[model samples]
Target: MLEFDFCSTVSSIFSTPFSLGMFTEPLMLLAETAPPEVVAGDLAEPSEESLFSVGGILTLGMLIVLQAVLGFDNLLYISIESKRVEESKQSMVRKWGIGLAIVFRIILLYVVVKVIALLQEPFLNLISHPLEVHLSGHSLIVIGGGAFILWTAIKEIYHLLAVSDLGEEGDKGEKGNSVTKAISLIVTMNLVFSFDSILSAMALTKSLEIMATAVILSGVLMIWLADHVAEFLKKNRMYEVLGLFILFIVGVMLVSEGGHLAKIQLFGYHVEAMQKSTFYFVLAVLIIVDVVQGRYQKKLLARQAKLRLAEQPSA
Candidate 1:
């Protein structure tokens, strides 16, 4: 101790912070606990590798998966919208529509960060007794989106159920000029659908780098998968009806969610924030029953047709 020099003392003082090892302690514990441990050498230092080295890749994968799951409803809407175009152009419209929508979303993502709090403002209220309701920026998007979805679904269902068929058409009718309309509808709805995801991503991380990375990765996944979703519906035929019904339910969900965002209350109860798990559960049961009943009905019709043919005199 009597031999201490100024240089050594300064070095010791500077090294104290590093020796404390605030960051390394967590990594050591994480290495011990994290799966797929390496055993090439002693686990004491973790081979000087970072425990969070792969966090970027892992986060990208997770965001992609989450985006795909959340975008199912958007995909369904896209497919339905694309059908308004001529058969030859439907695929192209879907591809381009989704592409443009992604670009728009990226722009909106940047803009939203500055105005995130604007979406939370309350514009109006409800009756007495502390029951309140108001329209905020977020609510406007959601409610408007829901209303649009509901209108489209109802129109499609009506056309499917009531309209006789596509039938014959004049040349002008055949050139419905519907492709542009389809693209516009899809792009508009895509923007509407982007609100929830963008807002959620903002809440998740403050880093613009992280948010941008996640959004771009998710957009790429949607672009790759949207066409497949459309084609699946095109091939299934019967599932189109099911898809329409699902769209209706999604519309209802969006309206409820928007109302909640707006803080709207009905009577004394808040109908908007009701748990949608129950709605989905009941809908699943209903779909199962509908499928069984449909199969039974088809079988009965087939049996009747067979009996009638058998009862006919031989030709």
Candidate 2:
């Protein structure tokens, strides 16, 4: 009879460095000692499936949909930013900006896959009675991007409010933005927007090819849609305010997300991330209100015109 000391065997198993062999050793030993009539089947190593497999294809489709849903604010930003450039070059800016962003996004996806842990490691620690913030690389980037976007939205809103003459505003608009500067801003913000989608994609699948494909396809869609969105905004100028306010909300959402990631505490209160559902709900309310207000204003103007015509002498 072959007697085995279970405690010693377990101790030896743990003492050795972990490997596939460690798992197989016990099983092999069992097979060797078992009756001759009993036989063990060969263990085969796992192989990676091709990217075109059913699972991979499904993941790719899901990732593309995720990109589109997350890219709404990004698309809005691109449309508005492109308009800042010369009208003739606006389309070019959008295309080039999105094109460059696609390349950078792939690069970023690679980097994140390689050094995700490094990005999450907390680098900044500030603790005080009134304020507390533990910021990582990811959080800092998100917070900075959020701050810049908030500032831009607020500045534009102020400009709109300060404009007393439509003609002067039109002249200012005609001055336009430097093509390089506009494209630079669009590309930079596009990356900021990409972070969320990239992180979400990482959660979905580990395949870089799938994520990159989604990013490229989404960028092409944005380029194609950019002109239509900008033209709509141009034709319906009143909706510009609605767009700006939407951007303001996006900035707020980003700031809150960053704060949550950093575990920030202000005045002893913890900062929490804003839910996406809340954001969409607010957006829907804003759109509904805008549509209602526009129709109401048109009706009021028509009624006033009828009143004026009634008061005028017959002609």
Candidate 3:
């Protein structure tokens, strides 16, 4: 007869080399200060006796910091996407959309684990070149998420360039866009942004409690800050277009990454790939150039103003 035990099951879920490496030193200290069982079962949940273990507190802090780092890009994207709606409604949209999308994020976490297990099967065949790609769960997610972001970026760019005014007067073209339509677009894109975040959290731990707490806390923080970000973009209107273009670049990067994950190839080159470090390096150079150009332009304007004032006095 075969028998299963709770300790073995718990160990199988939480006992990993990486987890041990992260917790081992702190756990040793914790063991000396507190009971060994308490240190080991730090995450087992809030019991009456020990709801504030040192290990649990450290783990929560790390998760919060990680979530903050990951959520920065998403927050930027949210602020940019919410520009189409009325100024009064933009903050509400971001707050609610992000909060709702997290529910979907938790559901996707479970789905990805099952899908990754069957990722070896080839799902699509391209052509006579005999190149094939697996349409696994992650592939679909990457592709869908990428395509959605790309579409949003393109649409926003088009609206910026093609339309002279973005105020209510210019919304005649969107006369058919009901409140429902606007909210749907906002919510849809929120999910797209959540895709990478949820997948990243999955790699950290299979503990649903950890993932849920991180996401919930992050969502709350995002909601709190969404309005301020929206207001900042409004005040610094010059960079709105630049910000949208950055989002477009991010979308392209996502598509490239998705292609790489699915082993996609085009003309004998991997389609979905970019060195992240290189991308950031190039972006930094571009930002420096932009700053320099802005300073030079400002000085030129000041000099022109001085010359005009002198000429007027002489006249």
Q: Which ten residues in a row have the lowest lDDT in candidate 1?
A: 35-44
Best candidate, lDDT: 2
* Better structure of 1 and 2 per lDDT: 2
Estimate every model's Cα lDDT from 0 to 1: 0.65, 0.76, 0.59
Structural similarity to truth (TM-score) of each candidate: 0.73, 0.83, 0.73
- Residue 232 miss distance in model 3 (angstroms): 1.3
Identify the runs in model 2 with alpha carbons over 4 angstroms from their true place: 1-49, 171-176
What tens-digit string does per-residue lDDT give for candidate 1 at 84-121?
A: 66877878898888888878888887676555555555
Clashes, model 1 = 0
The alpha-carbon root-mean-square deviation between model 3 and the true structure, to one decimal in Å, is: 9.3
Cα lDDT of model 3 by residue, 1-315, tens digit: 111232443465466554322322232222223332332233233332221455444445555655665465577777776665665666667777787777776675555445534432446655535465655555666677777878978887787678767674334333334445556766666666665555444433335566677777887888888788777767766566666766776777777767876778656766645544444555566667777877898999999999998889554
The candidate 2 region of ten consecutive residues with least summed lDDT is 38-47
TM-score for candidate 2: 0.83
Model 3 lDDT-worst window of ten: 23-32
Clashes of each: 0, 0, 1
**Candidate 1 versus the native: TM-score?**
0.73
